[model samples]
Target: RVGEGVRGKVAVREGNGGRVLMMLATWPTEVSGDVVQSVDTLLAGVRPLPEPSVAVRATPRAPEPEPGDPR
Candidate 1:
């Protein structure tokens, strides 16, 4: 899932042998032709994950709000 304030595009598709292929692209600022180029560059260097897969998990911790008298 995309986070708030983030700018990007993502796509997911099923690959051969029931594997899932995910593509995520993020631009630091805004989406444009340059962002497409960035995505291409990132994809070019990607390698498939090794077999006997390992799962990575994390629990998101909420960011602390700035000091204020009101919530």
Candidate 2:
């Protein structure tokens, strides 16, 4: 995971067999498209984390919007 001062954004998908795979990339607030591409390229080459006995996995995700959200 990227450390302090670098913020991450994520896009999540429900995988086969009910698993959840989250695509998380750390970038600056005003990040360009190239920066995002670079992060994606890096993530694609990585290995998975060690498996636990249970199926659950945890990763960063955006909080659900509150009722007062403008959208």
Candidate 3:
């Protein structure tokens, strides 16, 4: 798990009887995208975090009227 300023590794087992070894590392926010991409590319062959799949969800919110315009 990623925290404020530390990084480490953990062993994880999958429900399908597969084992995945991972190295967890945290990077400072100041790090550039290129560096991150490089690291991702290097680790592409390794099995990634298996338990939790990364997801992005958008929540619907009330629409706001445009500035200087009548609703």
Candidate 4:
């Protein structure tokens, strides 16, 4: 399940019959597209946090496939 909130977002993940994993994100005043890119970066295992001086005009990353997905 995926949900967007007033400032936060949450994605529910379930596996192995009863296990669950939840991914949540929040960004104040940032474009939804940018936030999505950040989430995709994280999910892709790219762990480098951007420097504060980096501008949003920087190239966005291509989205990665979800874990275990055939695509």
Show pairs that collide, candidate 2. Answer: none
Task: Return whichever of 2 and 4 wins on lDDT.
Answer: 2
For model 3, what is the alpha-carbon lDDT of residue 14? Answer: 38
Stretches off by above 4 angstroms in model 2 are 1-4, 28-33, 37-71
lDDT of each: 0.65, 0.67, 0.54, 0.60
Error in Å for residue 62 of model 1: 48
Backbone collision tally, model 4:
0
Which candidate has the highest lDDT of all? Answer: 2
lDDT tens digits, residue span 1-71, model 3: 36675433343433333654555545665677776676666555455444443343355577998899787
lDDT of 4 by residue, 1-71 (tens): 23353365566655343655666766665467777677767755523344344567578887899999887
Error of 1 at 44 (Å): 11
Candidate 1: which stretches are off by over 4 Å?
Answer: 1-5, 30-32, 37-71
Model 1 per-residue lDDT tens digits across residues 38-69: 77777665555555433433555677777993
- The parts of candidate 4 lying over 4 Å away from their true place are 1-6, 40-71
* Clashes by residue pair, model 3: none
Q: Kindly report the root-mean-square deviation of model 2 from the true structure over all alpha carbons.
A: 15.9
Which rank order by lDDT, best down to worst? 2, 1, 4, 3
Alpha carbon lDDT at 32, candidate 4: 71
